[model samples]
Target: MAEVKLKNLTKRWGDFVGVDNQSLNIKDQEFLVLLGPSGCGKTTTMRMIAGLEDPTGGEIWIGDRKVNDDLPKDRDVAMVFQNYGLYPHMTIFDNIAYPLKVRGTPKDETRPRVEKAAEQVELTQFLDRKPKALSGGQRQRVALARAIVRTPKVFLMDEPLSNLDAKLRVTMRAELKHLSRALQITTVYVTHDQIEAMTLADRVAVMKHGIIQQLGTPDEIYNDPANLFVAGFIGSPAMNLINGSVRDGMFVTTGGTRLTKLPTADRARAILGVRADDMSVHEAGQGDIDVTIYAFENTGESTLLTVQWGKQRVIARGDRHLRKEQDDVVGISLDPDHLYLFDPDTEQRIRM
Candidate 1:
């Protein structure tokens, strides 16, 4: 187990900067996730740490040594790519044993290590089969077992679960989480999927345009976003951002409806943010504001109501059994304790 550190790390192609100067410290045995949309430089940052890509400027340190000049093999880290890079002709046992073989572990020492790694990932039953016979999830486990077969100092996984189907991804996520906890290895995971980051990370670094926008635990990133982009990015339905202004301590929507009271001073422009689960739905005129429902969706677990608030629409997660239809009028109320205010011009959060 080791701590991974990036100090003023950067990557650039001519004028295009893939990773702007960024610095982060991932603790020993910590599961850190780099999360953002595509082209946000999360993968680039991980590549630098893995020795797959060199930094344009800055340092990459793993454990007590500076690994900026080391080759990938010398860096002592295992990587699991998105494609589950397994050899087609090798049996499951051979695939898992490749790392140990390359490093020249004795023939007698190899079998038990491979078997132990396979057992950790629950692949013991299929060791005799080849990669072609295994399902996608099983193939992913093989890749994982291969990585763990060597006990490298650090583990770098770049969207390792992205190729699997949705259900498979969830199952693999649990397996990955369990494995990480049991192994206690430092891991840096890259993914654009918010759900993945929220579920697997001990700490999440939300990035954009090659810059880390916010670094926090799941709860902090979800409940206490540092900026408009983070508040809008981390949630499933995302936080509903409504354009408006603050006047005399009251937040007024663009359509002239005073939505809620703000403790801050009056401002000409502001943005109101509230999550779907934070807002409640009710009969027309029963809650804070009455609006016509534009669309109603039943997602089995819960119902979602997209209601019109002036020219803007806000989605509210309703009880699963609650029924509503398009154009139906329903009252919407914001959870004052859960509300967020942001400065429109700066796109930064405002202290409540």
Candidate 2:
């Protein structure tokens, strides 16, 4: 049982707070991701778990032991950094074997473990080559092999695919998913990429300014966001937010055009949220409201239309065969079942 628990964890540098009082439980053999942008304290939280940084307050536990006072090497955790962190002078085999050797494993036992780890990462043939001769993806596998050779209690990965190119990153994402399930190690991963968090994590903790804004599965976060920040940050093109108000059981644009039926009884001011895909396009005068087209984009799988409504512009996801031009006119209707209402002042979702 390698469950991890952070109890009111915090990191403070004098007046600056890197990680506020945050508590979380990561279950055994679960793949958990800490997701947020830079300076959001995701990395700081992981470092505290790894024993690389001391917490200003709270307790760090691994299984039955409190590990706040333990050294990084004594914590029995493996970390993979963004830069690959391979030795330039040593061969790939030696690089992967370094961890085992430093821990005083016998030479005879080290060879089979190193070889098995290398084979798992598809680096067996390149074991004799130096780091300078390998590609970005190959060097990354060397780092992974080094970590897997020792069978640590927990895995801490910090943006391991950020250094790779876009195409390579996609391929590596699949590989990492496969490897994680095969090893079944309790893992804590930190990344700013939403796609990575959605695809890799069993549960994601989304943070901002040192506070966790929401924690849920990918589908829960995407389909039903807790707040404006979460709804805006999770989607690809983002959810479209229209400034409007509720009046007489209907939502009216600031321009006084009645757009759709109001879910709530009546609120003087509110924000209507809908994703591009939830909106349907039609010929002018046929839908809820007619608007002039601002721009049109074709992305192969689907087309996107940026339509002008009142003083605001909202994007609508159109069919792949859709063909429109700037200055053209079109009508957009919001799906009633998928629409969201939020209080403008508090930025929280309105249940009604």
Candidate 3:
């Protein structure tokens, strides 16, 4: 396996820019994820690396060779797409064997390689079945098996789980994680799903508007976001960004409620960043601020209480067994150790 490098990489069409001068280093055998919303250029960046899209500027290096002019097939990269790019008429075995067959591998070399790849993805029993006969998850595994059959220097997966149902997506995530570790191949995964990025990535590059907002491990991006975009985009419910100002070492909300004390110096305009998990729910008047519940949700694993806090509604995570109704009064206190401050003007975190 070879490490992939992008130096000042950029993609442009006319005056519109798709990827704006982004540089990344994906180490060999590393599972790196490019995470962001649609049209954020994550897909375009991967396409450029695959030689499917032309870059306006910059170099792409795989191992010791720069592959800017290489064809997609010549780049030694296998890509699995969201739609499970497979032939409906071909048996699962044939699909997995396609890459080797196309590359002119001997018939003797093809069968065992295909069979081994199919077994790795738990598709051995379904090898004789065509893609149309398999479930969504099974089809995706066939796609993965096809990729791995090549044992390419790098694997590019683009939202390979988005088409699966929620439960199957979860199951596939675990399988994908295990497959990645076992293969020990460099992989670049693209997805807008924060949960996938958090669970699957060794390190995540969070992107927005064609720019990388933050690049770090899942813990660093979640617990210590570099900017407003990362803080808001990286979480399920997103970090609550309350409009406020810091006065005399205390943060005050727009409604004149002094929310929390800050260790940083005073800022005339700032945003207080806190996650739902960082706030503890309490009985009425038991915590720092008392407010009425705007909405209550029970999501099996945990309960979410959206409470009216001054002029804004804030969501707080409650114990799974905790039940509450709308209009119920409750108090929520912030975890001071996890609180984050950001400059509203620049959207950058204010570190003490």
Candidate 4:
């Protein structure tokens, strides 16, 4: 219900900088996700927003008020951590009602609100159960219900589903997205899982080495990454970075296969960046460069095929029916419209 903003926010431990000068504006009632690999400063950024970790320098604004010195409880935000942080001795009902109790709400008023929260998370039947009695997903739901009962302006979640099984995590991902939409609370979720960020966030901020690499909607981030790090990070099987040189408006690979460069303003210096799904495979032919198939993995609906052209390996997602095997020869063609061009030296996206 409230917008969250960070202005030149930074965090450092001695000489080691955890988060650099990062400025981001999370819109009111928007579901924004901070995404990156480990040690990328995502968790540090979230903790700073939740008032758990103080920033080395910069300002944090919640709604319209500056809250750099505010306590976590005074920040009007609820956090659901990876560990759930439930009191194992307390029943689910009491756990959900703890926030209201701390606020000194009368017991009569706390019960219905707690029950309503439990119902919202579909944990009404497990109200009397302890954390030890509930499954991992159920415990996560209990944690969610506890956070929801307070009805805070913002919700912060740090890899809340990482502890669950893969199947359970997928199920909970959908549930959390639906729950956030229904509650319409400003949410800031942190996770290293690209798929989770892609599926759940309205906009994802991809970070690396304490800096934001790119900030965009899922489709934008997936289709049009800002730099090579984001281009390599946001996709499954990752995008293929074929090292080639531009000559006469065409890209010449090391294996001697030449493909016409897509018409760009800076066609003189453009490196070919192609996504695995954007490349099509055909039967081996004269114009096709002979590639040694490194591996082919069947992933239910599609197959991930890895091919080595000289020393560089590139991946292509092909149809499940394409009977390719290790050491097989295949012909590949890049989808020029979907191709990304990057500066060879800086690795930044070249405007086309």
TM-score of 3: 0.98
Whole-model lDDT per candidate: 0.94, 0.92, 0.94, 0.89
Query: What value of lDDT does candidate 2 attain over all alpha carbons?
Result: 0.92
Off by over 4 Å in 1: none
Clashing pairs in 3: none
Report clash pairs, candidate 1. none
| Per-residue error (Å), model 3, residue 163 | 0.6
Compared with the true structure, model 4 gives a TM-score of: 0.96
Best by lDDT: 1
The true-versus-predicted C-alpha distance at residue 339 of model 3, in Å, is: 0.5
lDDT of 2 by residue, 29-64 (tens): 999999988999999999999988999999999988
TM-score of each: 0.98, 0.96, 0.98, 0.96
Candidate 1 residues 100-172, lDDT tens each?
8888899999999999999999999999999999999999999999999998999999999999999989989
| Residues 1-352 of candidate 4: C-alpha lDDT, one tens digit per residue | 7899999999999999999999999999999999999999999999999999999999999999998999998998999999999989999999999989998989999999999999999999999889899999999999999999988989999999999999999999999999999999999999999999999999999999899999999999999899989999988888888777667667777555676465655244456789999888887863245566899989989998898877688998888888888998888877878988788789899766
State how far residue 218 of model 3 sits from its true place (Å). Answer: 0.7
